[model samples]
Target: MSPHAELVSRLRAAWLSGKTRPMEYRLAQLEALGRFLDEKKQDILEATAADMRKPPFEVEVSELSICRSELNHTLNNLGAWMKDKHVEKNWATQLDSAFIRKDPYGVVLIIGPWNYPINLLLVPLIGAIAAGNCVVMKPSEITRNVERLVAETLPRYLDEDCFAVVTAGVEETTRLLENKFDYIFFTGSPSVGRIVMTAAAKHLTPVTLELGGKNPCYVSDSCNVQNVARRVAWGRFFNAGQTCVAPDYVLCSVEMQEKLLPALREAITEFYSPNPRESPDFGRIVGDRQFQRVQALLHSGHTAIGGQTDAGERYIAPTVLVEVQQDDPVMQEEIFGPILPILTVASVDDAIAFINARERPLVLYVFSSRKEVVKRVLERTSSGGFCANDTIMHMTIPSLPFGGIGQSGLGRYHGRSSFETFSHQRSALLRGAGRETLNTPRYPPYAPHRLPLLRAATETKRRATCLLL
Candidate 1:
């Protein structure tokens, strides 16, 4: 039998046996999982590097550190998060006490993307475990090294009956999704997200899709040009710009574009040196298919600086293209590689209009010194998140919910948001036996005389509680 099938059977048996009922047991499992990752840090980093040619430090910083932080934060806050929160009770329901109870959904499926495999997978896993739900983690098969490690190491460190790793390509995922799940959490492209949602519709499973769109970075005239370039350069080429939240394209005035491109080129040279492919810090496109796709994008533009390639090595240099039009193929889809296309606009309003015409993005970055302009952009454009005078740093804030809107994706999850997403907020109301004054009028008889009393009672606040003398 397949590994996924075996895992499903085992988890189903455990679920039927009621072994996953207690919150204490689930919390214990979460604590153990965190420790497992802590102990296997080196192994995890090495595996991720082998699969994606990522530098060890990059793997540690971008993937491992974030995962550890998320796990630790969830562990620290789980007790408080699980406690029923008290809410203000209305006069209409004044006789009752109101609070929200967090309940676990039965089984969940987390479909992680290839980029930042460990971060996307482990962070969501933290939520599912914290919320006391059994999980089926389908790590991207494209990250072969990390997938192998997760499939092998997880069972050793975690409760096999509570969490399982299902490793396969499309066919395995298809068969697995055929089974009913309480929730589905997916992070990848919108194209694939549509398919996931359509499949999920079969079972009416709630879905959390963290999908990607072309996240645009706008460079305004009032901004510090050099700082904007440095930030954009880092975001554009990080993870070879395979990041879903990476700045896909740039919009600026003619003067800003001219000044910005050179600054960006300088930043790239400083960050990765002239020969980026040979630099240990730089990354490559994941495979030949990605390399070809990026190469095709380069062919569509007037290359301003550094349009070079090494197909055999899967290397595409940090490139900058200028004078790109709205109709260019590079503009047609997401350029998920180390390529930056500068689209010039006359004014910020024009830039806003251009962005508004397309699908809402995952993030909109505004590099402007003027607070009013930044505020206007934020008000006008609807992205999952925004950053001013910077790019991608908004994702670092654990307080902010990180996800997308419209074509970018649906639902948000991070820290408290993740806990809420994984858990169902069931509400309850309890009343005392003696406080029956409000209930008497609300029951059976709909009298004209009782209407004024009900209205007056609801409009006013309750007085202080007093004990009988």
Candidate 2:
């Protein structure tokens, strides 16, 4: 058998046993996962740091804490989330019990990304486990240290029968996708997302793709320059600009761009110090190839600030580029590095036009103290999410859904959205044996008199609701 075939078969058998269906079973498993996090905290920090020089604070906030929040939130709410949601009924089903049952999609595959490996892998896993599905989680092989750590450690805490973590590189991952899954949740680039989707199409399997695109940050002239610079710098430079939701590039008027350049430099210095390479808080690109790709993008426009690169360490200092054009290399793709390109627009309309001209981003950012400008940008452009005066802080809210639209990605997951994504909503209605008399309106006897009763029985219109036949 193929590498994945046997594993899929094993998980499928476990799922068929119906052991994962009970609320108690799910809670127990989730609690075990929480224990894993608490026990493995130091190891995770070390692994991420070894893999990409991910700062300890960054790992704590983005990796460890986000996951714990997801875990605790799931633990606190799983009972309620699993309960059948009773929905309102039409006249035809008024006497019946009608509800939407959230059910697991049998065996599922969760493919994680390199950036924020722990959070991305486990957050979705939390939902899948809560929804009671046997899951096979594949963390990105790019972050080798973390991948190895997860492969070695994660399965010990959870029931080995219900959940398993697999480590695979590009070829192995492609082979793994050949096997069928009830649902596939992929977090990666758009190109790989297409491949996963195409593979899923053979089985007509459902998929949720969390993809990345060129997220544009539009800075209005009315905004505070320092605030905008600091916020954008934080979002873009976090994870060394490897974040999917990070601001890809900036759009502002020439005047604002000029005013913002010095401020951005000051923000970078404040956050990472004058010598970012020496700063412990700064991170390196995940891999040498990624470093080279990001390094090449620096030439897209004149370097306005720090553009230092150290190939040996795979480190690129927090850099800013001004006089960038729409057709520049930096604007051509998602800049997943510590390089920020500023392109000037004539006005907010021009900025909106520039944004609309390209594919929809994962998120659209507009920094303006004025409500009208913020509202105008929110109304005109299309993106997965929006932040008025901030950056990635919007994603910190568990209540909000984090996903994309169009080229950015498909479907959403976070908090309740995560649970909903992994679950299949099964609509059901129960009728009592005594209710047969109420079904007399249909009876398959085609007649003019029956039409009125049938309409009355099924009426759902606000002004014309009828509860009797």
Candidate 3:
């Protein structure tokens, strides 16, 4: 057998042996994952910096800290999440114990994205562990340094028999997807999400796709321009704007656009100084291909502020474009870089119409002081998540489920949602053998009187005592 097949077989064997089912084993694995994060803090920071020139502070906050929080949250709530939950039932089922059993899908496959490699990979792994399933993690090959770090170092902290990390590019990933798995969790582009879902269809496997889209930020005139610009600029330029939920473009009135331009220039200068390329907090493009793609977009609209590029260092300045049209190339796809385009709309209604006309975004931001204006936008459009005045802050809360709608992506995973995504809620009903008389109505005995009695008993009503007779 091939190495990949053998690895899957080994994990399947371990799962079949019931080693991963016990609460003790699950807790130990979660604790070990925590230890892995804590022990490899420096290594993770260095690796991410090597792979993408990501600043150490950004790596610590966005990558390491998020994973640690997820691990800690899972540890604290694993028992409560795993416990069999009793569900209310009808009168007929009241005599029986009806509860939902959170059963783990035997083995899971997790495919991580390159942007935030460690967090994307390990966070899902935490959920699979909490759900008591064996896992095979495929870290993105594009982020070579961090991929090597995880493939080499993570297994030592986890049970080799129950968890494995496979490092490869497209060819290997295609082959890996051919194999059967109980569940698959993938975070990447929508085009690739389609491929993952197609492959899983062969085995009838379930999948959760955390894909990307053109997230829209609508700025109303009823808000503070400087505050709005600061929030939007930070969200748009964080990680050099490689974020999936980053505001892809801004939609506002021409008046608001005029006000926002100066404020944005001020915010950019305050955040990254006059020469942003020299700022240590700023990051470069991940590779030459990404650099070239983003470089082509700088020519889309008239550059309002900060349009600088360096091919050798893979640097693109935190840029903002004004007078952009709806059909421009930059407006076409998810601009996974530090390029923010502003398209002018006549009014808030026009902005909502423009947003509703395009593909549903992973996130929608509406900046306004008026509650009614925010309420109007929220009630009209559909998105994976929404933030009234801020950007990318909705995802920080663990209680809110994070996922996409329609083409943006499918399924969600973040706190209890993550555990539930990896689990199958098996409906369980237990009753005494002496309850044979109560079950007679469900048995096939040709009796007209029984039909009326059964229908009346099961129908929606306050009193069911008469039907029982």
Clashes in model 2: which pairs? none
TM-score of 3: 0.97
Q: Pick out the ten consecutive residues of candidate 3 with the lowest summed lDDT.
A: 460-469
The all-Cα superposition gives candidate 2 an RMSD in Å to the true structure of 3.0
Reference-based TM-score of each model: 0.93, 0.97, 0.97
Per-residue CA lDDT of candidate 2, range 201-251, in tens? 999999999998999999998988998889999999998989998998998
**RMSD list, candidates in order:** 4.6, 3.0, 3.3
Candidate 1 clash pair list: none
- Residue 312, model 3, lDDT: 96
In the range 1-469, model 1's lDDT, one tens digit per residue, is 6556677667767766767657688778877888778888888878877876898878877887787778778877888898999888666766578899888777889999998888999888888888878889999998899899899998788888778888879988988887778899999988889999999999999999999889998889998888988999998898888898899999999999878878998999999998888898988788788889989999766999889999988889989998788899999998889889999999999999999999999999998999999998999988888988887777676668899999988998888899889998898887777866656776776778788777766676668998999
Estimate the lDDT of model 2.
Answer: 0.92
Ranking by lDDT: 3, 2, 1
